[model samples]
Target chain A: MATTACFMIVSRNDIPIYEAEVGTAPKKEDAAHQHQFILHAALDIVQDLAWTTSAMFLKAIDRFNDLAVSVYFIHTRLMLLHDSRNDDGIKTFFQEVHELYIKILLNPLYLPGSRITSSQFDTKVRALARKYL
Target chain B: MAPVAPRSGDVIFASVERVNAELFTLTYGAIVRQLITDLEEVEEVNKQLDQMGYNIGIRLIDEFLAKSNVSRCVDFKETAEVIAKVGFKMFLGVTASVTNWDAEGTCCSLILEDNPLVDFVELPDTCQGLYYCNILSGVVRGALEMVSMKTEVTWLRDMLRGDDAFELQVKLLKQVPEEYPYKDDE
Candidate 1:
């Protein structure tokens, strides 16, 4: 079984900028929609917790059975859903994603709170996931 | 002791950090295309770009302050110098020459010899009045506003619009005094 399941990047406005599934688990017909609902549901918890804590990395904020979600909040919220219990590895993943997000922000053309549709950005994210996830 | 000569803007920017010019140019092109498609009006595009730049500038100022570690400017002249030498160099990897100071010294122009955002860009003749580089001016205005220096920034010349040089004019309107909202009334 793959340790990592799904990765998603949600903008501050609660829009999903990017989403990818890294696990080898067989596809479920409703899995994509299910993941989207779960991700949005977790966001409320993230916002409530954000006020009390100043940490960028919020480890294991929510879970459903074996599935767990880890969040990193900078200008946007980067969430990772996985089956494995590697706390340290998930932190590294979020860190790398945050770096790429900053690079995207540096682009004069790119706007904050917009969908990230750059193919180059997508490719880089996948490469990072393959390396670390 | 006599004050040491200030380093030239070019000298300070000589070894400044750099990013991929192609990435910058391509991303800018994509953004322009998207704006045109969505707005469908040349004038509207210009306004949107300026608004976007203002938002970016407000956030970017934080990064600039953290990285440059420079103190607040004593005056508008010094502010212009810092924007040209330090602000532009640190973020854009380019230095603009500050020139054409008005008689009052509250207004000046920044001459950009090379603009990475306009590399390989050609403005359509139909959009003659559009300020392709208006975002730069917006950034200046937005950044200055944050420092309590309310200023007006406009593009005096644009290479994309067939101008000989890229020039941005900045005019100081007034400085906004900081207000403490929670102070008790005497």
Candidate 2:
């Protein structure tokens, strides 16, 4: 099905801090670009939907054909654009990544709202992606 | 009265007023952020943090002594052990391993597998020259100074810098002749 599991962490101020393309199947360069474009386009919708409820997880908020957008917000918005509808796996992935994100945030050296550029963090997120997503 | 045995860090920590870890962590993060912004240079910020830690260390030694029931003037070897086993545990709730001592017993490394001050930190490339945990070195230096041990402390390894653990190399420079924390006793 050429599955797409592109995940992003956007800071509260609407800056993209971390992004990972964790698709199970191989994806084309153009498809990856288009996926990011769609993900960014959905951020506006996410902001609007975030304040409407106190809940952190908004499952499958906005969908475009086979692509589904799931968001988990806590100071930073964790958005995943995936092709499947596994709510449990997506939620688990979000929660685990949140823990990792907090570790990044807790660093006295890390400036808030800056791009997250750690290879270790990237590698762990990819591994978690394989495990849960 | 028989001399009292020194209290364990766990016992002293249990009696101390401790704040929420997250609150403390975030507050420290904010302070560091403010320091960087105000200083505009990572090196300056590092120095400022060390200075702040030095001030805190000097004052903290009094509370540490009164609470831990550890007598002043322990030898360098015992001082390092107490710092690793009791001092860190009392304040940060984590124990450090003391290793890599010189034969003369003038130097050693305090290895911390877990550092409470460094939970959420990843150093950006711009700040590579900065020692994120420099304050810790200053604290050790300042604390030792009060007890008449002239020492130098440096970061041997930092977990933030991709090291396996946090290690501080503390070197005894020269032992000053016994001084007074006893000025008021007369």
Candidate 3:
């Protein structure tokens, strides 16, 4: 399904954290160490999907715009399962992610479908992307 | 412990001063026609849309946390409840409830009491089987799945239909990550 495809783009990004866990590097894999990485990745995906869909909805009037957006959102959630431990910490992390998104939406300059050219937007997105990347 | 009320601005059509959908659609059509004669690829368009949705989800979740102040859901049922009530209310001004919950609470039907996205438009023959404006399903599925619920969202009935109501069936597929690092312990 198109929805599945859109979500895959988000879930695939987590493969690295798993790789990081496997590596003998400094970030050793403790019992729940990977939890944060997984949660952050999911948070990033949610924000990304929301921004992208809002942009598309603004671009045109299509019958399937909502559906398309929904698919992408679902995919981002699906991708988050890889690192979640069903713990309280994960829940709190999502709450924080939710708060971050609301802040972004409140800003006036970052209109839907625009380039998201705001320095603040770029900085926040870059921070998340860099962490996940 | 107290339930959080949704803000005034989050609801769709909450702003009467803003442009209406009909007028907006007309303007959008004219603009698209003038700008790009050949539309881009559907995949490319959807990709762009996903990216946009990603951004919106980020910002929307931020507002949700600040306003609702609710923490995450511990299980699938909790996640579904939170999403249907808090998530939908904050974003779309609708509260979808799960009626006829199955044995495991995995198979459930969503009933939308009020929807703003389909307020004015009729589902023409072209858009029948399509989900009119339920991108939240993807967002919910993806967002909650990240919290640990493996969810599969399917439409039992499209929103644009003869009945005054719409139903979406959500099946909780299974636990996520077939081969998680902690699988051996479980």
- Across A1-133, the per-residue lDDT of candidate 3 in tens digits comes to 0111111122333322111121122443473544344344345445555665653111111122222111123222322232222234333333443454444333322222222223443355334332332
Ranking by TM-score: 2, 1, 3
Runs off by more than 4 Å, candidate 2: A12-14, A30-32, A44-56, A73-76, B1-7, B72-74, B178-186
Error of 3 at B180 (Å): 10
Docking class of 2: medium
User: DockQ, per-model, please?
Assistant: 0.03, 0.63, 0.01
Tens digits of lDDT, candidate 1, A1-133: 3554688889878889888887667778866577777778899999999898999999989998888888998768898888877777778878987888877766545566777766667788777777676
How much is the TM-score of the A chain of model 1? 0.91
Q: At residue A29, give the lDDT of candidate 2.
A: 62
Ranking of all predicted structures according to DockQ, beginning with the best and ending with the worst: 2, 1, 3
lDDT of 2 by residue, B38-86 (tens): 8989989889988988988888888888888776545788889889888
For each candidate in the order shown, give its overall lDDT on alpha carbons.
0.79, 0.84, 0.44
- Looking at model 1, residue A45 earns an lDDT score of 96
Where model 3 places Cα greater than 4 Å from the true spot, the runs are A1-133, B1-63, B177-186
